[model samples]
Target: MRLFHFSEECSIERFVPRVKANRTNMPPVVWAIDEEHEFTFFFPRKCPRIVYTRSEGLTEADNHLFFGLTSCNIVITVETGWYDRIKKVSIYRYELPAESFQLFDETAGYYISTETITPLSVQTLTNPLDLLMARDIEVRFTSNLHPLREAILQSSLTDFGIHQFNQASAQ
Candidate 1:
């Protein structure tokens, strides 16, 4: 599969990881990042659908899955394959604009612009097929202000103020 971030000038790169299946063949699956941690899993050929989530309790539609440049607001397009048959497959594309999100977060506050890339792998097959599913996927978000960033910096400053006060009391 090919992924392009508009902020990256639509440069497509391979995000799927190399795998060894039965010492010869390999399969494709979905890849994503959760809480700054990387995860790879297999996608079923029949369904070939995967949803990524930032929080644990969110549903598939509620998940914040954005794609774009890492820092700027730019649109992105993703093209992947869909299963048509065991030997034949079809391609589907999805396009999202950078201005789609109203908010984003880096530390605690949300930003308007961000990008993330991940690799993917696959396991288990109902039948021996050479179909390529979306094994790896990248998500980029573009926004004006990041809520997470604000939260982290604010917490850091609060802790620093407390530490300074403690030092003065000791003296």
Candidate 2:
């Protein structure tokens, strides 16, 4: 399967193993998302979002509560405040060979490699919202993401990703 690394910076030539500022205790590595889960990363790097999909054995009640009337298999919710930034930013998708990566998180489709990697190609996603629409994923904007974030944390919706939740707006 193909793996991808998404970033706002476009001039990246190669990715070197380095410790994430937030997780210095973890070993230095290159991180990439498998194609199956890359859609969640199609936004400004720090935009707070909740991406979820219906998993096996999901109850009808939970489905209706979490997804409502959406027919799309996946839904991404974000705080309304990030909309302007999301529209202004250009996201780059770096396609990397999957040889050296190991599965880090199955649900998140995260893979890690200790070796440095050079991207096979980089794609510029000019319109992130259109990308989501073309993928048939529902994008929901809410004034506050706290309520949904809290509910999803306590939810049976096990297949979910909460990206940069701390950066979300207070209201």
Candidate 3:
């Protein structure tokens, strides 16, 4: 399966999870469902440094299991798939117009999960409604001012375009 990541800069040859400004001490990696989601379009995703495959077609029960094993954030689209691959994944970058990024409702709640191990990951995202049906999974959505949203609003340039990605072999 092919995973995608986007960035404003073109220097990203490798997809490495980055430390958010609030949590610089940790070394977790993250990615989004696709460019369609608002959060993924606004932020960056990275593959870990381990050997694992992508987790796609997750059911509500599967989400509980996955969330229990590792920390993940929100779920936006039901079709979104996140991989646990960590073998230095290569990236193929494409240009995305800034207008492609459509923001979701900020007033709605969002999920936030985190893991501290080799498959270090963070799932900061918009609510994927299907994942909320699981009783065991606590889907705590946030309506606060997130860092990414702040960055988007504060930027002076409006003609910005994001660098979207695909696997190296596919390109």
Candidate 4:
């Protein structure tokens, strides 16, 4: 499988999960197969697309061709048909140690059902109880209801990397 991630930053050796408590802040790092997706850019007005490949993590491949410090063991792949999720959210999350991927699918019930949340306040709430737990929440992102989008915009971090992606080859 050859997946892609487009980003403004040049470095992505370590896949870090969005740690803030929100819809898209859960484990695994986000990546995409398409470049035109709406969420590709962090700063749409000033960002450039830097491309990464799964081959960077593959051995027996030329080191010069690999773009960054990606390792073979940490790349996490999602099951097929989940591609739409990537398009809708702009990118998909890939958790390392792999089993953590299910925490997204299995724990959907715990997410809040509304985006009316104060974007600024979401950053301050430190307790899980403050999020108001649920049991079976299915998330769908509409233009206005994107907390993850707000989170990204609100974040102070400089690296807004969006890796380009394609279906992982069945090697």
lDDT of each: 0.25, 0.92, 0.30, 0.27
Q: State how far residue 105 of model 4 sits from its true place (Å).
A: 11
Candidate 2 residue runs with Cα over 4 Å from true position:
none
Best by lDDT: 2
* Better model by lDDT: candidate 1 vs candidate 3: 3
Instruction: Highest TM-score: give the candidate number.
Output: 2
lDDT of 1 by residue, 13-101 (tens): 33333332422442332222222211111122232222222333433332322321323122111113322332342222212232322
Please list all clashing residue pairs in model 3, or write none if there are none. Answer: 48-86, 72-113, 73-123, 75-128, 109-141, 110-141, 110-142
Collision count for each candidate, in order: 29, 0, 7, 18
Prediction RMSDs, each to the true structure? 20.9, 1.2, 18.5, 19.6
- Which candidate, 3 or 4, would have the higher TM-score against the true structure? 3
lDDT, candidate 3, at 162: 23
Model 1: how large is the Cα RMSD against the reference? 20.9
For residues 68-113, could you state the per-residue lDDT of candidate 3 as single tens digits? 4544443221111222121122233332222223222222211122
Give the TM-score of each candidate.
Answer: 0.17, 0.95, 0.22, 0.20
Q: After superposition, how far is residue 121 of candidate 2 from its true place, in Å?
A: 1.2
On TM-score, the stronger of 1 and 3 is 3
- Candidate 4 local lDDT, 46-98, one digit each (tens): 22222222322334333323213544311112233343443333212221222
